[model samples]
Target: MQQSITPQHEHEHHESMKVFGFWIFLMTDCILFACLFATFAVLRTHTDSPFTGNELFEIPGFTAETFILLTSSFTSGLATLAMNKGKVKPLIGWLAVTVLLGAAFIGLEINEFMKMVSEGATISTNAFLSSFYTLVSTHGLHVSVGIVWMIAIMIQLKKHGIQSVTKRKVQVMSLYWHFLDVVWIFLFTVVYLMGVM
Candidate 1:
């Protein structure tokens, strides 16, 4: 005789699908960024561009932004570990630190954009500047969304503690946070380093 499937097994299967779906979404996200990167590559060397990369890019500021983001990623991992250990208080603390670091990153990025605009490096100035702003701003938008999602998860953690649902959410958030860090690493190398060079 064939055995019937259990409810617990069904639930596990469903959660696994949710994770698989998230990974699929991330793949599409990768495609979107890839297109933006390609656009930047083509426009990066347009002959009539007003500003050279080295003139507009600030090395020290970018370095600080990189450090902050990397730290935030580490804190996010700690949050996940806290959840796995069923420690709600430390999980909340770690999530708060990650959010604050993310906010700081956004603040610094906005300041940089504003300063560049004030110096006549506006997106409408040329193709190169347009591409640069679009790529960076798109990434900034993603980080902003992650921050909002994190706030919601923090609220849930407070209300529900580390239930199975909350645990899965925390895991997904950690995956997204780590993914952003990886993307920033590439952006730092391609955009900032290459610009300075």
Candidate 2:
């Protein structure tokens, strides 16, 4: 006789599929960011701007942003850990912390952009600045999306507590958070650290 699927089994299948689909999505995002990074590399020097990345980028500010983002990644992991343990409060608390850190990171990025603009490094100034803005701001946009997503998840967690669905959602968000942080590491090294060198 053929085995009939139970509701729990069906949900389990759906949960696995959700994670698998998200991985596929992340892979496509990887391709998109790779193209952006390549474009940035090619245009890093084709500039008419008065200042280069070395002169324009402040180490302390970007360093702080990196630290905050990396810390938030850790906090996100903690949230996931809490969820796996069936604890709702800690998961929500960690998500809240992650949101604050993400907001701070975005704030620093905007400040950096504004400072550059004030100093004559506008997007239209040159190919280099244009590429820089495009690559970095693309990452910023992703982080902003992540912040919004996390907030929405937090609301769901509040209403539903730690159900199977909520757990999977948290897992997906945590993965996305880490993915953004990994991309930022490359961006910091490629765009800022290398620039200052």
- Runs of candidate 2 exceeding 4 Å displacement: 1-5
TM-score of each: 0.95, 0.96
Clashing pairs in 1: none
Flag regions of model 1 displaced more than 4 Å.
1-5, 47-50
What's the distance in Å from true for residue 91, model 1?
Answer: 0.6
**Candidate that scores best on lDDT:** 2
**Model 1, span 93-171: residue lDDT tens:** 9999999999999999999999999989899988888999999999999999999999999999999999878888898
User: lDDT tens digits, residues 1-197, model 2?
Assistant: 13565777888899989999999999999999999999999989886545799889999999999999999999999999999999999999999999999999999999999999999898888899989999999999999999999999999999999998988999999999999999999999999999999
TM-score of decoy 2: 0.96
